[model samples]
Target: MGDDQDIGYAVTAEFYDLLQAETDRRQARRRFAEPAARARQAILDVGAGTGIVTGILLTASAVPVHAVEPSAPMRAALLTRLAALGADQRARVTLHPEPIEETGLVRAVDLAIASNVVATLPPPVRRATWQAVARALTPGGVLLFDPPPETLPGGRETAARLGPVRVGPDLYSAELTLEPERGILRSVFTYRVERDGVLQREEREAFDLWPVEPALLRAELEAAGLHVVQAPHADLVAARRTAS
Candidate 1:
């Protein structure tokens, strides 16, 4: 979502929204809605790709949001979506075009959400991110992200593939081939957009993803002054800022 991982997202960002099901989006909305409602100060969205999850946070609560997105294309799309919001909502969002470290951080945020961006974070970046998240959050502030299930290294032929969404006259598909090497999941994403049973456009891009150990992740957060807590949902990992 930032300078560390934009290379793989270039091609994928175009068809990102298309690949997600309506049910998936709705479920995601419901999952974060509670924290958004409870947030009094503000919410932070790290790697806010195309603002799908960010929009959910905005609509779920009447509070300001810090949308940190480093990918230009995705950020542009995010800006496009934010442009359609009512003036009040529009005024509440501050777009950070850089990584969390380089941005003007707010230390009183009530919640921070990182959707699909967590597992892909390299160890070095993840450490920096956890430290930054700790610094930005208010006491008892919440941080929720995916409990990324580890994937074994595999070739495209044997890798897990998802999508092939039908969109009126066209169809979209994405294949994720993971190569976990050098402490990163080198993901080769193959995207194919076709129409009327004809292959139209195909793109392949490599995304670097780093594995996360829950125990280690917990230790890291604790070191950063945050505590892993019971998640609102069974699928997410929730951490709260311990009172200083």
Candidate 2:
């Protein structure tokens, strides 16, 4: 979603983590940490939004990591998070302030993870990113990515509440809608802040979601010199680098 812009994690990073707090990332990192620990080289965290996954890898494994983040607001939040960690943890990470494709690394890592990002990008961007990520992995390196949803990007967000939180006397909330489409889905996010049940502020952000077919996606990754696997019950697309 970094087509010269942040992934519309709007309000300038104010309510990002709050709305995303529903997930227990600590528990979720188990599968990832296992593979990351066995990696023979550095790890890569593509679209390291706010460094959530990056932090998990740092604390769970001894391996060093390269974190590539392109959004200014998200990177600010990410740097803040990393700055508060121990010196050793900080030293183990190299920050790439650009998109993964533009990061200029070659077969540099043995494991990479792209979560909640790739499916939002259009075909061209996604293809370029896959090729670049494939080139950046060491032989047999594993790339674990989140596959797109059954619905188009913006189509899946419904009026259902995505996440809501209360801080002090203020409360923040957001909702999502998702549907299906062949072209890009323009999802709209509306946020409202309430102070003591009184409406304080309201804002809206637009995000573009792309559609990806599994067959085509698998072919693309295979053509890029990687063997692809989609877990039937999981929302994951795992690709391992193959022999040249």
Candidate 3:
């Protein structure tokens, strides 16, 4: 689950361009359709893995973006992408070499997003991260993010795509588990992938599980002083800070 760092620079790096191509269309639409026409001037993207979301922000809108990412490889890829863009677009991105929870970006932004990023965090961390997102924005700033279906019981079944996993210097056979009852599915087997001797990647994700209903997510947001704006799918949740 924490392998976001590796995926950004290590394994996903080679396929970064391909990945970006596949996601560009959808992100462009979201960028343009995001509500609140006030036109966010400053934005922050948490869990900005490989900066795929970052690239979308740059291409879809003219707003300045601050991307917070922890993976060393992903940050480099993000920088590479920025360098590839037109001079004006390139200047709009400011990279933060840290995770959302740790980022101390001083600017108060109008919007904050932590897309596919939050699903990978542990529960407590997820809550804390959301709190941080709320604190980082100006009054009434919006927070948009998506939680994987595994966040709801019976949702983990969708994560059955099994592939090799990598761990440290040692490699072992592993399998991905789909625990529908837990509303989460994650890598269950040993950390081993083909080619790579020691596993360099491992995933162990747990969401609210069955006992915690998906609607509870909204309650959590409110507890943090944010209100639900829209959640079009089980995979997406968007909210706005309550007016002060």
RMSD of every prediction? 2.3, 2.5, 6.8
lDDT of 2 by residue, 125-226 (tens): 888888999989998888997777544443354755755588888898876555455567666677888998898998877666776777888888888888
lDDT of 3 by residue, 76-181 (tens): 7677877878999878878877666677653378788776666556667667777778778888788877654434444434433333223344333434455543
Higher-TM-score candidate of 1 and 3: 1
Candidate 2 matches the true fold with a TM-score of 0.90
Worst 10 residues of 1 by lDDT: 149-158
Ranking by lDDT: 1, 2, 3
The segments of candidate 1 whose C-alpha lies over 4 angstroms from its true place after superposition are 1-8, 21-24, 150-163, 166-168
Which of candidates 1 and 3 reaches a greater lDDT?
1
Cα lDDT computed for each candidate against the true fold: 0.81, 0.78, 0.61
- TM-score order of candidates, best first? 2, 1, 3
